[model samples]
Target chain A: MRVSAPVRATVQRLTLPFLIFMSALLAVLGKADVLLFDRVRVVLADVLAPVLQVAGEPIASVSRAVGTVENVITVYHQNQELKLENQRLLQWQEVARRLQSENEELRNLVKFAPQGAVSSVAAQVIADSGGAFLHNILVNVGSREGVARGQPAMTGDGLVGRVIEVGGRTARILLLTDINSHIPVAIEGTHDHAMLNGDNSDEPRLVYVQPKTPVKSGDRIVTSGSGGMFPPDLPVGVVASVGGVIRVETYADLARLEMVRIVNYGLDGILPDGWVPTPQAGRRSHARAASSP
Target chain B: MPYSRNRDYVGFVARMVPGTTTFLFTLLSLLPFPVPSFGSIAPSFALMAVFHWTVYRPDLLPPGAVFVAGLLLDLLNGTPYVGLSALALLLVRTAVLNQRRIFSHRPFSVLWLGFFGATAGAFALEWAFVSLMQVEFLAPRPFVFQTLITAACFPIGSYVLALAHRAMPALSA
Candidate 1:
């Protein structure tokens, strides 16, 4: 059926405004916590997710290949470096062993010891939203894998970031390098607390530190877990100076992130009251204690 | 006589091919890929698709369709408001439509220059509107890079669309 010229013109004129109106309505409804729209978004995401998975496969494969090559090169250099560092570490290890025995004896004598717990799960980084404005990664693990929002994500080296959004099969992690990402951290040497804030830059700035706090470059920073949003004592980063601004050089190298450990260091609310274990549990406890301390 | 019927058939095929191809290309642009060093950013694949269609087949790629495609992108990327992208796309479509006479037969360099101009205008408008809404800055750098990459890929996209146009014998003028 051929449409009249006037009718065709009318259809063309109405189309743009109609779409504009519908889009605005959808946005408003979404903001209003319309359960229906949220569910729709989720459903659409589910439908499109497989396409994303397929498109991402080639990129992931390339990254893995590159990572393997880089790892081999680094390992060769590290092996030689570790040979020398190992000798010096042996002396430190002896001193540490003596100090550990002395401290244990003192704790046993005093009949007082604090114990904490730790548990973790391995996850693959599937997607990275690479930019200073919003540093986030999509992990394969999701709520189905017991990955809850606000759970602390880490790399082998130290704290990576926290999970902010979770789907049934995927979760979005807000990395420590994002401009809006901030965490309460404490300097290892001076025991001073400061807020690590990302400013769309590689190194996140340490803010709110007292002027008298003896925070120096190279000092280790760990999550203080003041608000309980994250587990305490997770190694966050080391203090670095860039443009005279103190920033945390995070332990997880954002440039080469591959696999990550999503810590299930179960929330304190889930723990049994005043119950503690020996040795193994004690070690876990010590790790937790050291995390905050 | 029979030539009128043939022309109608050709127009029908031309319209069908461009719409379907643009839709699929737009979908491809939204796929999430992990960046080794940086986090995730959805590049504007739909923008490139729309731009190509507008430049070569404006009759098939209309402003209304461009607006809808932008809305889909905003939805998939989780942007605050959908109309912002739609508005930007409409502006790009209108600009291209107005200058189609000059650009329709231009060399590749001129076409690319036109693309850069259109993309920059769209990006600036998008950034301004998004910033005004107080939503978190999604970083324009990635989008800028994506536009450049899309511009680079235009020849390929154009060629593919052209092949499709040619394959459908009914679409050939």
Candidate 2:
């Protein structure tokens, strides 16, 4: 059926406003129920995983090339630094060896059973959220590779984040600097519990400190394992500042994440296989209760 | 008749260039760039594509395509606000379409300046919307940096789109 020119023009004019309104509505409602989007996101990510991997090849090579050139220029300086570091590590190695033997003896005395077996997979960083307000990375390894939601992703330095969304061939890790990310962490030496909260900043802030022990700058932060989401004693970061809001400089260089090891510590934790926890969910309360003891 | 059909097919593919490039740029923005100190802010290549197509071939890249591109971006980014980018992009296209003539046949500097304004508006809107949604004053540093970085990189995105733009006329012929 052919419409009048005037009628067609009116419909065309209305389309823009209709779409704008619909998008704004979706944006508002998206916060209420992310389950739908989460499903779509994972499937879409899985489908596009190959395309992203192929496209990222050139960029990866270029970055590696640049790294090699920089390495050559800084070779002497790095050599000096590595020599000093090696000497320090050698001393620590001796202490660690002694402690291992003593710990084994102690364990035998107590008849203590070791924790369950741990498994991990190394994954390449294939995509980034690339949004000003978002901080997440998509890795090549996913459910097909034994990755599960809430598993901790780490680098050799320390904790990077946790796998929040896992598809067939890809997984999205919510970095410690995302606003919605809140991990139960503690001061390393004191074991004083606090929450490491990401406020969309380079350095995540430390909240809920016991205050009895004033956290000073350079205090090491580690996962408290209160929620069972992460295993105990995962190194997170060091306190960068002690101002109004204490910030943590993550040991893992989040700026240039090339690879991550997604570790499964064999704990079921707060999130089950398909449970996507909203920011306002009761999991935080559960974590609080679990940690109080 | 066969020759005309061939021309028609070529014309169809040429018409598809704008939409295809917009989607490709959307994907390009998601790729990890590996730039040191870049953080999470990749330059919004989708915005450049939309701005270019809207100014030059608005008939080809319509509002629906822009909305889809933005939706794809938000979904891939895994943000809670699924349609925020869609809304922002739609507004950008609408704003650009209104003043399309000014950007047409203009100097590169003028277009760059206009994009700078659009980038600022888009990011400022995002910063405000996110802060409001979270019910707190979110830090503005990343948004500010993104806007600046996007605008600064406009020349590169524009150059790539310009090459594709040049290929369009030949395809139609």
Candidate number with greatest lDDT: 2
Computed on C-alphas against the true complex, the DockQ of each candidate is 0.27, 0.75
Which pairs clash in the backbone of model 2? none
Error of 1 at A192 (Å): 3.0
Q: How well does candidate 1 score on lDDT at residue A109?
A: 97
Contacts from the true interface found in each model, as a fraction, amount to: 0.29, 0.74
User: Can you give the lDDT of residue A245 in candidate 2?
Assistant: 93
C-alpha TM-scores of all predictions: 0.73, 0.94
Docking class of 1: acceptable
Q: What CAPRI class is candidate 2?
A: medium
lDDT of 2 by residue, B37-116 (tens): 45467899999999888888899998899999999999998888999999999999999999888898899998999898
- Candidate 1 local lDDT, residue B16: 81
